[model samples]
Structures are given as structure tokens and as C-alpha cells.
Target: MAEPSKSSSPAEQPRWQSGTGLAVGMSLGTALGLTVLDNLAVGLSLGVAVGLGLDALQARGSSTAPPQAAPTTPGAV
Candidate 1:
């Protein structure tokens, strides 16, 4: 019988494993600070920008590999 393939699949990098919390915190803080400073527009914009930026960064770290189902063999039932 032929040996099973041994090549390692690309490992998935953990999400939010980097400076994600800092980014989120900074964004929220900036938004809240701006709101307190009577700059609603800037606060909203900053909050949205931060959310999108974090989303992009997080997406950059994760893999797209589909979850693989176990292989079924004949007469195994």
C-alpha cells in the first residue's frame, strides 16, 4: 500500500494573537474621547475606522482552509 502523504498543511494563525486588544482599546478610547470633546463626527469616523482596521488585520491572520472531513473507506461500516 502506498504511504499516506506527509506534507504539513499550512497551520492556522490564531486570531487576535497580536496587538489586537491595543488597537481596539485605542480606537474605542479615541472615539470616546472625541465624543467627550464635542466632536461627534470625528468620534464616529474614528470608531468606524478602527473597527474596519481591526477587522482587516484580523482577517489577515486567519487561514481559509476548509474543514476537512475524515476519509471513509470501503467495508468500514
Candidate 2:
């Protein structure tokens, strides 16, 4: 006869996953923070470039004047 395999509980799996997730999140956060600190000038320049590019795209069709309102009759007061 074969013996039954040991299976982990569902709750235990989630707890292990949660611990791994926290470690990964902390590592990523630390790397990103160190990157920003190490290259503040480049980051600022890139941010400004992106901001200006977005602004330009947003302003593409705004320079044209809007249509004028139609003339109203005097009796409409």
C-alpha cells in the first residue's frame, strides 16, 4: 500500500505567500528609492520632459478660437 502525501493547508499557503510578497515589495521599494537618490538630476530632467510632452499633446487643438454665439433677439429679455 502507498502512503498518502502530506498537503499544506490553504491558510498556510496564503501566509507564506504574504510573507514573500512583503519581502519582494520592500526590496523593490528600497531599490527605487536608492535609484531616485542616486540620480536626482536625471530623474528631474526626465520628469520635466515628460510633463512638457504631455502638456504639448494636451494643447495641440486649443489654440484655435471657439465659434461665436448667435445673435439674440431683443424680445428674449
Top TM-score model: 1
For each of the candidates, the C-alpha root-mean-square deviation to the true structure, in angstroms, is 8.6, 24.5
User: Which candidate gets the maximum lDDT versus the true structure?
Assistant: 1
Residue 31, candidate 2: Cα error in Å is 11
Candidate 2's C-alpha lDDT? 0.47
Off by over 4 Å in 2: 1-37, 61-77
Which portions of model 1 show Cα errors greater than 4 Å? 1-36, 64-77
TM-scores vs. true structure, each candidate: 0.39, 0.33
* Counted clashes in each candidate structure: 0, 0
Local distance difference test values of all predictions, in order: 0.59, 0.47
Clashes of 2: 0
TM-score of 1: 0.39
